[model samples]
Target: MKYVQLFFIFLVTAITLRAQTIPYLQRQGTATQLIVEGKPFLMRGGELGNSSASSLAYMEPIWPKLEAMHLNTVLAPVYWDLIEPEEGKFDFSLVDGLLKDARAHDMKLVLLWFGTWKNSMSCYAPLWVKRDLKRFPRAKSAEGVSQEILTPFDDRNRDADVRAFQQLMRHLKEQDGQDHTVVMVQVENEIGMLPSARDHCAAATKAYRQPVPAELMRYLTQHKKELIPELQQHWQANGGKTSGTWEEVFGKSLATDELFMAWHYARYVEAVTAAGKAEYPLPMYLNAALPREGKQPGEYPSAGPLPHLLDVWRAGTPSIDFLSPDFYNPRFQYWNDLYTRSGNPLFIPEIRFETGDEAKAFYAVGHYDALGFSPFSIESTDHPAEEPLGKSYDVLDQLAPQILAKQGSDQLDGVLLDKDALEQQITMGGYVFTVKHDFTLGWSPGAQEEQWPLAGGLILQTGPDDFIVAGTGLVVTFAPVKGNDLIGIGRIDEGEYIDGKWTPGRNLNGDQSHQGRHLRIPVGDFGIQHLTLYRYR
Candidate 1:
């Protein structure tokens, strides 16, 4: 009996170790794929509160909520001030608590290092560092007035950040390293200097006067056609020089100055990340504060990893994996389109948790091929089941396995319908569809013209002749793609979500089923349906 128990213990230990290990991040086509526990893992994560872990008393109540939301990973901020109140002394109780609780809940974590910047401010720096301006100076505006941003030129700031980050990494390696609770680390939380396009400090001035780095210039020249649209347009309209100083090459404008600041800031954070990765090399990424097109530098958050500064950031920082976007705007597709250029993976770390916009989540996961999407303040909702956002997440959780399998393949498509936009069309697996608003052909004519009903749709092709269409507020009609003829084989109604298992629902084979190519749910509500078809002459 003792020998048998010992053998079982050894088997369990080996399996645990194998489940915790992960490899460095690499690019798979246009997407950044992470190898976790010997499998290709896509991050489906949410950003927790910045100070949520400081006291488990606060975080304990929210554990059950997160787990129920079907979140695989959580993005939590680790403040430098709280972790290292003094210069060299480091405290990691908060980080330890986060790791232990995350593991207990069977969730992975992405630690956001709130070091040099947090939302374009140095508010997260240690009190001692923030108090002593001489040791760790702040950036100044063009008028020589100090701003809340930490100067990238300050060696003391960089050293303190590196030391704190290294200690955090070492602790993670020792404690959760074997279990791999933490999969990735974000170097800094939106590092940027705002309220001014360029710093007027002496050190900043000196650096700005220097010529543009040869590597960055080469990248710009080589990839000019693929540059950020606004930047490329500016350069092309201004002679498009391949070699010169920053002003001479990119043109002397507020946009150019902001790009210059981004280069310096990215370089500084890269150094900090490199120091930490030396101890335990894991995948690391950076987050950016996006800006509007016609907005000025100060009008919007500036000096971050916006697309126009992609060249500077790519050339300045190679240690980071990819730059992610935090969404607070309505133009989800447009912003993601800009960020995904040059083969960058799309990862939305934050978005508004509005009940009406639930369908956007589906579009992000299915249509856009985003690695992950998290709606901010996820725990704040009092009744998740009743909320549209929560219900959408529930459906997504049900379909996660299918979605994961078809992530890189062309087997899925999603749509987000607005009140003004009443129709959407998509093609998958040799079938073309024209899906309209549920009220398009039925109900009162005024209903279709009234406020748009918020709805989402997802189509998955199981086989060449089989498909499943699921969601709300949709009227689907299918036709063959080009030369092939499609005939309806049968319809599966009374969809069964069997014990969290998706099997074929009961067949609705009668007059209820149309001639196979056309089916309509006149008054469509929240539901899932499977339509099986056959190819014939």
Candidate 2:
């Protein structure tokens, strides 16, 4: 009797713990407030390849590598063809294997659903869908050539995708739902029609010639500034009315035509997402392939969730939690700015997984207050520990708690220092600081002639008089803006991280500590440090 009672108690406790864990999802605002375990959670994720999770043999060696990078979430894909090889035959084996491995590794999963679109192409549709031209139709070019796009107008295509997604969601809810191993689901992989902006098929053209939907016109009128550049230009050129036909309201341009097709595509996908969410309401997000400047639709990968199309998408589709950016371009600041402009929460699902841009990760977390940031192909690196990207993530993992608490507020700030430009000014905790390059401060000019060191730092205000400064190759100074009594540097605390803990490496004293209320570290490398200051004459 006693053994049975103990076992029952243990089971209840595990069930309660699992119930408390909230799946982290996107929230609206400059500040990211993801609720996980019923509290605010921040994501530190790494994206795997499209089909990397299909083979257990290929995934075995990569689990430990992911853990070493301090990743809390892994972004893996569920291929449509693999899941439904034949018509009406759905397989859950690949998904089950992925869930099992993720649970074994003690990690959360973000499942990418590779359905109608993958990288602006319909390459991931099942063999039956691909082979059958009558049951599931394809889009056509302006020249009437057939393209490999699954038509949104096709009921069979919609039904198949919805059925497959619903099954996946229901199975996850039955198996891992209790444990909550799967945190979120991506509805489709960059859903867009390419090689042509708007499908020129009879069905698509008939629908395109119809009047603009009332909801989209209202959305454009209400949020005019938030419209995409191309859409905005078309609307303004045609007098910007909210009550006209599609061509009259949006103008008869290729941009408007693409928007029409994109609206239907987003609506179709939203229907599929709504069906899946009915079974299990975990957070669902969609990613966009950004458009290049001076590139027209189909010329550059045009349609997937760029800013102008967002209003149309949002008005037409309500099932999606957020639209995220996949970062392969160098304009990190510009893209992030656009995604967050409409109070949409920022969550970078994919970024270039290079070693040098580790500092940008800090800015994404500390500066933008992003819900989560993930780099693509996380398991591709051989030596993750020694690599700069790994090192940066290691530091972020250590500082996650503090970062979560004070991000988006003025209490925290970070810098990504480059060799070409070295000066930065930041205001935090009632002090304005001017940080200069090594050469600007009259440091040995030879330091510039030689390989310049890579350095970045994060500053956080712990209390009214207490602050922490952690990073490499930084010299900090403190001065009061208003009064003299509130302006003096007191001490410096430095430390290194070992086995998931901060061990004090060194403490600067005397001249190194105070020179007219300024604290400076002449030489430092990859580590963390804390500085304590007092207001005095």
lDDT of each: 0.75, 0.75
> TM-score for each prediction?
0.90, 0.89
Q: In TM-score terms, which candidate is top?
A: 1
Global CA lDDT of candidate 2, please? Answer: 0.75
| Residue lDDT tens for model 2, 1-537 | 999999999999988787646475534334757766665666778999766787988999999998888788899999889888987788888889888899899888889999887887789998888999998888888888888888887778889899989988888888876777788888887777767888887888888877787777778777777676756877788887777667877777778777888788877888899999998888898998887777788876556777767777787778888889988876677788888766677788888787545666766776678778789988888987666666667777777777777866788876655566575777877776555433334465535554555456677788877776655455666666566655665666677556646677666756555454444543234456666766656
What's the CA RMSD for each of the models?
Answer: 3.3, 3.4
lDDT of 1 by residue, 1-537 (tens): 999999999999987777456555655444465777766665556677666766877989877877766677888888899889887788888888888899999988888888888988999988998899998998998889999888998788898888889988888888876788888888887767777887778899988888877777777788877777776787776688876777887788887888788788877988898999987788888887777667888667777887767766877888877888887766777887778887777777777777554667677776767777777767676665555655556666666667666666678887767666777889888777777767665554646465766666777777776776666666677677787675555665646355657666556555434445455543334556777766677
Stretches of candidate 1 exceeding 4 Å from the true structure:
1-20, 23-30, 42-44, 441-450, 484-489, 494-501, 506-527, 535-537
Pairs that collide, model 1: 419-452
Highest lDDT scorer: 2
Error of 1 at 235 (Å): 3.3
